[model samples]
Target: MKIIPLGIWGGYPKANSATSSFLIEDKGFHLLLDCGSGVLSSLQNYISIDELDAVILTHFHHDHVADIGPLQYSKLIQSQLNNDVKTLPIYAPNHEKDFFQKLTFNKHTKGKVLEENKEYAIGPFVIHTIKTTHPAYCLAIKLTVEGQSVVFTADTEWFVELGSFSSMVDLLISESNLYKSFEGQIPGHMSGRQAGLLAKEAKVKKLILTHLPHFGELNQLVAEAKQNYKGEVEIAKVGKSYFLSN
Candidate 1:
């Protein structure tokens, strides 16, 4: 399996960059993890809109799903051109009904509810979700394919159950959205050191710090995470791919 960062910044995008979005691919099936700001434009740099098979949203936050509208429109245009009108399946939580309803854009995209603790098979992946600690209701995702497993913390603070839930995964994509000094000031986001602590607690083979803060020397986050984690720790870069093996 290969996971690519389409946009790594948090809250809002930096100049010429984007907010939280990742693309996961395995066995020719492409799954977009989020559809945040600039994602639709950044995505074309890697693959065309039609190549995307599905999308799974963590929450209704603008930084996480802003491009969802554009994505639906892209499909609408593509269908008009080719006459191949297959509604792309978007799996998401229904915590906010208004946002959830907008996911269905007639012939372009359709929304599928992702229930807590329920397993959904999408192509070669088995998807699982755990509720996350965020302002808006969010679900942390775990995807397993052919014995290769990876967990994404989405947007969350340090939680005991989350550590247990991600135990022994091959890769942990964590939201390292704050510095150690400002850890608790942000009510729902984790600090660099907190991300490492979770990686150590979960015993993950590798860690990727994502949903990054826009300032304060990005390398500090990697260094802090490495202090607690023995595994490889990297700051997610847009357009970079992290490959996973079984």
Candidate 2:
């Protein structure tokens, strides 16, 4: 399996860029990880909207779910244009027990709810979720395809339990939205050092710091994470793909 960063910024995208989003591909199944701000415009560079298999959201934060409305509209328009009512399933954590009651517009698009910690299959992937420490309800996601696994922290602050949740994954994509200097100053987000600590505890193969901050030199995040994790550490770059190894 290979994961590509469609957009890397955290709260908002940089000039002419996009906010947090990713694409995971395996066996021709394309999974859109998050549909944040500017994602639709940036996504066209790689795949057409119709080609998307599914979208899994981490949270309802503006930076993470901004493009969802646009996505729904695109799906609506495309199905009408092709005269094909192909429905796209958008899986999100079921904050409610009865999430099937979510918006199901003409079968063009639908909502799928996931119960936290319960395993579910989405195409070629086995997925799970855990709640994150954020203002709004959020979930950190884990995807396993074949023998490899990946943990996307989504958006979270430092918590000891995360170590076991992500344990021994092939890759741990941790959010490094804050710098070490601003460690305690921020809430609901982890710093590069905290991300590294989580990676170290999880014993992941490689660490990729994502949900990047727009300010400060990004390379510093890598440096800080390396201070705690002696493994391969790198910043997530847009349009770049990271292949998982056995």
Top lDDT prediction, candidate number: 1
Per-residue CA lDDT of model 1 for 16-42, tens digit only, reads: 988988999999999999889999999
Cα miss at 164, model 1 (Å)? 1.1
Best model number under TM-score:
1
User: lDDT, candidate 2, residue 85?
Assistant: 73
TM-score of 1: 0.98
Residue pairs with backbone overlap in model 1: none
**Model 2 CA lDDT for position 152:** 96
lDDT of all the models against the reference?
0.92, 0.87
Judge candidate 2 against the unseen true structure and give its global Cα lDDT, from 0 to 1: 0.87
Query: For model 1, where is the 10-residue window of minimal lDDT?
Result: 237-246
Per residue, candidate 2 scores C-alpha lDDT tens digits across 204-226 of 99999989987899999999999
Clashes of 1: 0
